[model samples]
Target: MAAKKNILLIIADDLGRNLGVCGESKIKTPNLDDLAAQGTYFDMAFASTASCSGSRSVIQSGLHTHETGQLGLLRGFQGLHYFTTFDHVETSPKVFNSLGYLTGIINKVHVGPAECYPWRVREESSTRDVAWTAQRSAAFFERAKEEDKPFFLTVGYIDPHRDLTRGGFGNTQDYPGVEHLPYDPKDVTIPFFLSDVPEVRQELAEYYSAVWRMDQGVGMLLQELHRAGLDESTLVMFTSDNGPPFVNSKSTLYDAGVRLPMIIRTPGCTPGIVNPNLVSFIDILPTFLNWAGFANVKGNRKGRSVLSIMSETSPLDDWGQVFGSHTFHELTAYYPTRYMRTKRFKYHRNVAWQLDFPFPGDLYGAVSWEGMRNAEPAMIGKRPVANYIKRGPEELFDLENDPEEVHNLANDPEYNETLLDMRKALEAWQLETEDPWFFRDGISTRVIFNHIDAGMKMPDRWDFDVNSPGSKDGAIMPHSFKEVRGRGAM
Candidate 1:
């Protein structure tokens, strides 16, 4: 029998397709660049969903976002309706564990009901003494060496997301004078919210700094693997959960939200090959299973192994379309948007919110109903007013021309046929996935506000207080006082 390949999956949070290896000279990703040189780089790779939890769910289950229903961050008093990666498949760790391979996870594994530990996965960190990424990963590799068993390890890094205020590094205040990369702020184009400003530029610089720090962590893990003499046998895959946290990127269905950098390195496999074929995040699960010599594992996984493509045995002819979607963000708001991406064009459909009240802007919240407020122009109502007063119900962008998605071609007379085709495609996908939106109770604007109010009470450790005054439904903003703590109803 062939020796099982040791799998090391390293995932960076909110990393976009911006990297030195991807021909972007702005960012410094030497480790990733080197990995791409040794293995295959999937140029048009995309996440199943844009949000972290949603993307993670799809990656683990080998299912699409609509199929999994693990859309939003918080369940919003809905009590966690989404099916997670853990809820679907035999857990990734369990698969390796069953194979007698030492399996472990380091750092953020946010999936499924937080209160219930279904898979019995072990945590390498505690509240008081949180384990650093490199340290815990090195420890796992050491144990793998001692046991003489092939290992499947996942190291999750929380960097370049949104500095620590909302579960991020939160030390951007300290990292002053870090030079911004070559991507000009004026040309730092995105779909929605926030025009280029000094504050935005500074935030970008901090994000890059965090990326650099994450690279150090990767270096440490690689060094340890080299010392253990496992580098030759290990299959190292480096990727991110989703795109950068810029407006329409992180939580929406744009390319910036779904498109991610993926580098896979197998010692005996091909090197420095850039595969432009479209691939989904779900494909990782099957690829890993096949690499481990376990191709018949049972589950309702929806991805095919890309190992053939990686090995240069399969032709890189037109890969099929990749899909992405978004259901919920933060606590409030449920915008169900599905996307269909072929090599040339990308189509988006916002089924729930036909009139864009405040997309991208709503990410941080326009008013301070809860302790949530974004400093962006859209939130401040300072953006140039549009004639439509809202975005269209559906959107189609010719990615070949409008790579940044600055133009909406859905209503164009010339592209009417293309638009109809995409709509049918998206509808077919929704039906095939059996999406909850197809048969769920309507989600009202009021309910969304209530959830946001509830989230304010238990903001993540990194969140800052949004003290701005604003009203919801013309009602006075709720006050937070020491004596009235936990008294207000959500």
Candidate 2:
């Protein structure tokens, strides 16, 4: 029989496509670049949400934020307590532990309920010190070796993330072997998502330095793995919780936010293959469970493992679309938006488009934000601040043509057929996932199902009033998901 493979999942905080392998040559990421070369690099991977705690929760629970009940940051978002997954949601740690893997997390476990994530070794260090994390992870590996058990260790590096202060990125301290000054403000490429200003450039410089330190940490961990004679038996995956900490990124669900990197070095797989599969954070748990021999995968874990097609160069039939769900970032940033992104088109349903979008605590006070707000153009990249904050209820974008998502074609008669098709597909997904955000007449269908079951006639148009769209020719009746699940929604 083959030896069971160990899992080393390294999650970088607030990192975007800054690595060279991801086509960002300005911000050097040698460790990640080499790791991508050593295994399959998924080109189109996404997070269920764009916030830190919410994304990590999705990674662990293998479910969307709507299903997991992680509506916002899990803890200490501006010293205000937030929420976590329900106790019933089985987290990655809990599953791997019960299935006989020695589960341990080195830093930044932003999930909840001890029973859900019963980590055998949990070190809740919020340190950006990579060496300490590397040493701790190695020690955990040694313990697993000592007990003759396969292991699952997560090294959550808090580098490249914003510090408590407005423009800080935890880069004030000198590291042992990392380059103290990785890049200059003029050298680092300003992402298309941010404005070109002094504050934004300087912040990117600091952010680059922090990412450099995090890469050093990655190199150290890989070195430890090699030294411990576990290189051939371990599956190493490197990913980020969300996009970079920028004004237009991080907390929003644009491609800059929800779309992130997924690099995996599975044992005995063909190296240097670029898999174009559309994957998600929810797939992580299923992949681990697949490695750990846990079967009977059903219910709310609405994701399949990437193990079957990790090295496939071309996109598969079923790997073409992904869903995104977001409710809040802090306790206050409650702009609920759900999206369905296919290979070419993206559709968004902004549940709270009536209210202005709230910014996360850090982004609100960011220097980049301040610069853009006061700039002559007053833009976050090419997007107007007004259009960003006050979004439309429905939006449709042709990602192949408008990669930046600058245009909304929902109301355009030319794309009406395409828009309705994508909307139906998204609604069908909501029904299958039991998403509570599926609305009718400004109310959750699930929330008002009792009234519907008791024969309350309702306007069938989505979340509309009397004079709104499709209210005149209303398909008014008692609602049923089985009836509403539209055709071609497969």
Candidate 3:
């Protein structure tokens, strides 16, 4: 048998199909471009969820976001009752650790609220400093070499995730020469829903700068691997946790929120191949396990191994449908939205309330960390909130025609059959995965406040109405009708 391959999975935060290899001309991602040239790139790959916690949950568990019950980004929510990626359940990493592989994680390893199991070793560190990503990753590899064990190393980079409250690139200075890149707001393409204002353009520029910095980090790590004589033996994979962080991107069920860039480089394996088959983030766990030769690690992981597809030995019939969803954010009760994507189309089903501001009354959405405080005053009233509350119960898009998801065709009489077929498939998947939202009660609630009170008098026009489902007061209430469940307490 061939010597066991070492696995290195590198994840970038909030990345999309906007890389140079993906035909994006404005951004500079040469490092990733080179990696894609040497590896197999999946053009239709998608994240199981849009937010950090949700997508990470899928990566660790090999289960859909609904299956893990971690559909939202909140630290604590109703989804905790189910199994997680790190749980001692059948699909835990212990299966691989038991097989004599040393598994270690660096940077953001948000694998749910479950306490760390005894199987895997984790080197926790702050990834805010982009320079440390490669350095720390190299350190982990050196440790693995000393132990003389084949390893699975996961490196998480927080770059390109929206910058801190300042709005500039977080670690761009570390990747010198990034500033020299063409910073043209005109080159930035705003999403269909968001206005193409100067503020949005400036935000895109900063976002591109961060992407350039992350590419530098990748180059640094690849150099270290090659220097240590591990490049040929290591199976390196580069991907993103979710899509870009924008108004209709991260939290929505649209393609912009879930589609990710996935590249895998294996020695003596196929190179420079692009597979347009549908692949989900949930497949990562099983793919890693299968590649490590632990085909039956523990339980039945939900994903199929893409190794066959990567090698070009398997036919296209082996590929299957992919699903994604989202639940919580800020302190608002955004309705749960689930998605089912095939090769040519994507269907989004909005369960619970169909509010316009999906996460209404959530303080975080209003406060754009970069010192911009709810600049749009028109979004603070009842009509807007109510309108958001009554949005589409279902939405469908033809990827070939409307890749940007500009129009919703679920209600169109011509495509009723397609909508029904997708909905049926979505319902079946939810039922099989045992999603909690399928059994939940009435719509979730979120309480908005007029003014935060640090140490001053409450707002004079404070309004309170229990029956209205949403309130504007000094304190924001949880979305639950009975009582707020987890974490967010007034």
Per-model C-alpha lDDT, please? 0.64, 0.85, 0.67
Q: Candidate 1's residue-wise lDDT over 45-124, tens digit each? A: 88877777778767666777666656666332345444443343455665667777787777767666543223333453
Better of 1 and 3 by lDDT: 3
- Candidate 2 residue 140 Cα shift, in angstroms, is 0.2
Candidate 3 lDDT tens digits, 192-294? 4344456667777877878887888888889888877798778888999877776556666677778879999988777788887888887888888888877
TM-score leader = 2
Q: Best candidate, lDDT-wise?
A: 2
TM-score of each: 0.76, 0.94, 0.79
Clashes of each: 5, 2, 6
Model 2 residue 326 CA deviation in Å: 0.1
Please give the ranking of all candidate structures by TM-score, highest first, separated by commas.
2, 3, 1
List, residue by residue over 1-490, the lDDT tens digit for candidate 2.
7586799999999999888888988877888999999998989999989998889889888899988888788787467757778788878887777778899998888777656778999998888888888888889889999998999998899988999888999988775655665578998787888889888998899899988888989999999998888998898989999999887789889999988989989778889988888998888888877765664654558888898897799989999999989988888678889998888998999987899988888888988789889999899888999888889989999988898888999999999999999998898888777778888878788766555655666677566674654444545454365543332121
Model 1, backbone clash pairs (residues 3+ apart or across chains), number: 5
Clashing pairs in 1: 164-168, 164-169, 164-170, 165-462, 165-463
Q: Is candidate 1 or candidate 3 better by TM-score?
A: 3
Best to worst by lDDT, what's the order?
Answer: 2, 3, 1
Worst 10 residues of 3 by lDDT: 444-453
